[model samples]
Target: MNVARLMFFAFMAMSVSSVSFAQDADCEAVAGQRGECAEEAMKAAARVLNDRYEALIDRAGSRYIFQYQSRHEEHKAFLDRLKNSQRAWIMLRDSNCRLEGFENEWDKPSYSADLNRCTAKMSLERALYLDGILPAH
Candidate 1:
């Protein structure tokens, strides 16, 4: 019994670790675009990806809210609360990213890069969260 339990836990640990590694790889790929778009005209590619991720997050959240409302029509107020919470989260995310951008007080482009990375990372996380809550189709 003890060995069986240990093996089960070990498998669970590996599963969790692999999921995290996959997430890290995804984030790295998102951040890696900086190198490809380093040229002058395409400099804002990171920011564009961040915006795209944020839009996706918003769409996922809306879908979740719609599903929730449909399933719980009596709790219509939940939709408003979710909207308010999402707005607050967006403000917090922007503020946090701005703080990250200021980590290197002098280099403007470096700051922009850091800020865009932060935004992309956070937006991806939010999108993942929203997707998890969405009703299965």
Candidate 2:
């Protein structure tokens, strides 16, 4: 109700609404910090893709009662691809972790163990790539 309280609430809302993982950083670093960026990317990508699909669905839904033509069938195809891509990306992110361990394969057990940190690093790099951000060789 008060200004301070309202501001606090607004901050909390913004914090909750804004995802913290999408940043411009090194993909290797993101992959190093979190093996799950692939997962996050998958989710984020799916959301973006799904939004597009949903829009089509809405238009098609107007034609059909519950099911969608361009929306439902098209999404089915997109969803399958998205799942496969997400899984592959996660695997790639996890596999990348091997490098973070000083190239020590024995350092980590599985990618899920440190996927979050690694994913964050990956997300940052992806953000850069999307922004035309390139890494120095």
> What ranges in model 2 sit over 4 Å off?
1-70, 103-117, 124-137
Question: Which lDDT values do the candidates have, in the order given?
Answer: 0.54, 0.46
**Which candidate wins on lDDT?**
1
The runs of at least 3 residues in candidate 1 whose Cα sits more than 4 Å from the true structure, single-residue gaps closed, are 1-75
Worst 10 residues of 2 by lDDT: 128-137
Q: Per-residue lDDT for 1-137 in model 1, tens only?
A: 36755565566456444544554465466675653333321223334434545554455556545655544443345456656867887899889988987876498767765665566556545544443332234
- Candidate 1 Cα deviation (angstroms), residue 79: 2.0
* Tens digit of per-residue lDDT, candidate 2, span 5-87: 55655664454235443422333466564445455544564454345444543434453334444456655665566457556
The TM-score of predicted model 1 comes to 0.49
Best candidate (score: TM-score): 1
